[model samples]
Target: MRFLAHTECFFGKSRYDDLHSALGNTITGTGIALIDTAVVDSAAVRDLLSQVEIHFGNAIPVSAVSVLSEPTYDQLDDLAALVRQSDPSFILAIGGGSLLDLAKGVAVLLENPGLARDYRGMGLVKKELRTMICVPTTAGTGSEATWTASFIDDQTRIKLGINGPNVFPKYALLEPALLVGSPRKVALSAGLDSLVHAVEAVSSPLATPPATALAVKAVALITKHLPVALNSEEEDSWSGVQMGAYLAGLAMLNSPGGIASGVSYPVGTQFHVPHGFAGGIILPYVIDFNTTRGYRGYELLNPEMGSNRTFYQQIEELYGILNVPRNLSEWGATGEPAIRTLRELTLNQRSGSFNYNPIPFDEADLNSLLHLICQAD
Candidate 1:
């Protein structure tokens, strides 16, 4: 494995010093999580301190350094209050998927308290958390790359993201080459996950102009280079991977993903399927089912979108592009009892996908949806 360091600190406080005062944050504070990738040195800490000082007119205290492999919500309770306790003007997040997820959790934690479960599901909270600047290293998860973070709720054994337009990061620092050394599976899965984000967002219920553009660009980039991703080690593959991944990020910048994602979390965690593959497994079925409602227009939003196939055929073509199995059976999910449960969980997940479906589904629609998934050979 190759290791690289990306630091977010202050070299010149003067740059942001005036900006901070304008925000009326003269006594700003900085929140740091200690789970960074590189060796932590005094130089790094000093630079961070200087940046905070430049903004707040004084050095902010670095309190609550928690270390973990990635981001977690189980860290501290009363997140909003904890941030208020420090009363920092800025929160700097530096780490991988887990850390970025935790930063988002903290962003929520600081605003609200008591059972994080209280805030589960879409658009539950509205108030923004502390000002945050996220710097991503692995290029996977693009967690910093986006506003929401997915964290596992150990109590429920399900992973849920901190949802809300407010949670989108104030800004993210992405260096493409940083993704080169990542594990092959994680890189592929993360890249594919972005495609789902782009697709669902474009076909989503609200289908905003900005979101459609993002999803289209994401599809073009991902389709163009997935083969190179699987086969080549060329240095420029970094550019392909970076472009595809960023396009995925841009996909949800306007609209969030659909039901496949909503229901896949439980299915994936329960069945131990990688989230990306599991979600992708059902994407075509959902699209085909949604066809009853005229989802074809969604595919045309992109200048270089798929062509020549019927909508369902185009969806099948999409699966070929993703390089995952054609059905759950291919992934070893074919027991009668297991398939039954799988169908049920997937039906449950369909609710989250409401925005993108061309038509609304009732219990019977879910039955049809499940039947398609179970027999998708």
Candidate 2:
């Protein structure tokens, strides 16, 4: 079994303060802070920025920028250029997956000699990236723990991840307080994204024993806590979901994702669907397809469900509780033409995921899956 070391994680109610204190003492040079626009105006973020200014003082000159969701390659190049002028010692990413991804891309570009597009595939980064500390406000993509940063290629309109060991964040700060006031839809989508990650990781053919263990525990935690985190204001619930998401991300570091992840990229890039929502929506169908073909790996994900209902059914029930749609029709991807387009795009852009999937899903299988995903609920 292969094992990969990941980010050093700090978890708690006020871990951000701890991070600030640690960095303030250690970092004597300039740094760049990327904040998600969604939470830029929040009191928590405001206070966090205030603390950054106070703690760092003159020792570290920090520049803050607001980033939007679903960053593109152009945005990465532009942000890298802006940060290059500062010659930052580190990057502090505060936000959800997209902002965190943007921060990772910027970090890669700062130290690498070429443009962001030059390193779109795996193991292309010859230089170590500047230190990146990811502070995720949401419990979704687990970008803080993962070693890949996804972005859209504006020239081709394709979503590709800049993947390698260099993309891993040096530190991850999981503070549940930051997730307290997120919109229900945003929180649910993010939680479901983590759920899909855990499920897919466990089901991947490349999954090691350690990776499966983490993914299984992540699945259990997400299934139990995501609903509570969404419905209640309890920090513990959010913490549970957040830890689950982080574990899922770590698991996925060793195991590649399956058809659901492959489908998400095309659907998200073409239809403007949120990545997490698109993956979550199609996950159940993918599970069903696998199980019908004699893949029983998912039974381990939620062993507590027993034999009364299949694991996929339980996931569907969770979606019902969360009020997430079952397909991409809501994003205007319903017709046959949409399915064909998504199939071609998924084949071209994300074939690696399919190659690693436990079940060998060919073009016909992909077409079928896309039909299921684009079908009306």
lDDT of each: 0.58, 0.83
Cα lDDT of model 2 by residue, 76-176, tens digit? 89988988888888887889988899989999988898799999989898887788778899999989988899988887888888998888888888878
User: How close to the true structure is residue 203 of candidate 1, measured as C-alpha lDDT?
Assistant: 75
Look at candidate 1 and tell me the lDDT of residue 348. 60
Q: What residue pairs clash in candidate 2, if any at all?
A: none
Cα miss at 291, model 1 (Å)? Answer: 5.3
Deviation (Å) of 306 in candidate 2: 7.3
Root-mean-square deviation per candidate: 7.6, 2.3
For lDDT, the strongest prediction is 2
